[model samples]
Target: MASGMILAGLGLATIGFGARFIIKQMPTMGQKLAEATKTFPKMDSKAFANSKYYKGGFEPKMNKREASLILGVSQTASQQKVRANYKKLMLLNHPDRGGSPYVSAKISEAKDLLDKN
Candidate 1:
């Protein structure tokens, strides 16, 4: 009977030790979870849905330098060359051709800016 009691006491002590170890690790586990969340934030679906391209009224004014870069032309390119490049880029980036509307809009804006300048 005395040996059985000693075995039961040891079993209870082991369980208590295990519980204490898990309780001590709880804060560390929570800290790791918080750090992971900060490193990779959840995506905001509403922000993506509110893009100007999705809204259909986005008219971004392209600058001369940006326009030249977008069209892959030199800033000193002649009007004819700019127009040709613009046509080529539009053919490649048009939304109807499986391109993104945002990219197509930017290309159109670039052409307008280059033509105006």
Candidate 2:
């Protein structure tokens, strides 16, 4: 009974506020969750990417400038373009699709680094 009343109140709120109810912030919450869940490999797991495409050998922790270079974006590229490039690269480096997980992780780390700026 109380749950129904809460839902009813939510419906009223939707009607009053043009459909923005308590669930309206779900996407933001999901985005934050995704950001929180982003992971990069530890140094213990970093060696031997052995990717067909990556000939650079063992890499250290990614820095801002290196991240921009890894994503193939300019130092001044907008976040939108950075994201676009990240997606494009991920498509080519996704593990199940015959790409390297280490490379994928590095790519993701690069994107996160670039997005921060």
* Candidate whose TM-score is highest: 2
Please give, for residues 3-108, the per-residue lDDT of candidate 2 as tens digits.
9999999988879787465369789989988887786545553465654564555358778778887888997899999999999999999999999999899999
Q: What TM-score fits each model?
A: 0.47, 0.50
**By summed lDDT, which 10 consecutive residues of candidate 1 come out lowest?**
52-61
Q: What is the lDDT of every predicted structure here? A: 0.82, 0.84
Clashing pairs in 2: none
Q: Listing every candidate in turn, what is its Cα RMSD in Å to the true structure after a full C-alpha superposition?
A: 10.8, 19.5
Q: Which residues of candidate 1, in runs, are more than 4 Å off?
A: 1-61
